[model samples]
Target: MVNFDDKRNFYRMLLNSEVKVTIIDDEINSEFVATCRDLSATGMAIEMSHPLEMGTRVKAKIESANASVQALDVKGKVVRIEEEATDLYLVGIAIDDMD
Candidate 1:
């Protein structure tokens, strides 16, 4: 028997603070707003009103006024999605590139 587990290269920080997020999908030529749930060096989890399909390539810009961090603009792919409630979803994005 063989076992393999998904591992992360960076540490994740619990960030409950509200931050502005702009998600852009070039394939659909659409963009939307979302809120950040948590952040890490490699990725971040976000709460979005609209559900994005898994594997969607996106460009995102995250801006925060919190004293601990600075703004981030990156391109990533949607890796996972979980429904938290009606019309709300939790999205996991894997950071691919940074600007």
Candidate 2:
């Protein structure tokens, strides 16, 4: 048996924390509670109850405080979506801006 490593620009860290995901569009503006599955400097993977369309711009905020920071806010775009289970979707977001 052989194992192959994934080729990625940035390393991803596994995180199972709850974060707020907001999608603001001309037609609709809504927010959803999502779980952050993995996080990297450039992007993150989140699991949400609803599926967001590809190319959708979103805002993600981490409210919980860690040893280093109090909170974090970032602007991202939806890059990919995968159905994890019934009524659940895993979304891949590319970070555009960070604050």
Candidate with best TM-score: 2
What local distance difference test score does each model get? 0.75, 0.86
Among these predicted structures, which one has the highest lDDT?
A: 2
RMSD of each candidate relative to the true structure: 5.2, 3.0
> Candidate 2, after superposition: displacement of residue 24 in Å?
2.2
Q: lDDT for model 2, please.
A: 0.86
Candidate 1 vs. true structure, TM-score: 0.74
Off by over 4 Å in 2: 1-4
Lowest summed lDDT across 10 adjacent residues in model 2 is found at 1-10
1-99: candidate 2 lDDT, tens digit per residue: 112375777778888888898896635768888999988899999998889889999999988666776677999999999998998899999998998
lDDT of 1 by residue, 61-98 (tens): 76757779877788888899999999989999898898
lDDT of 1: 0.75
Model 1 per-residue lDDT at 79: 95
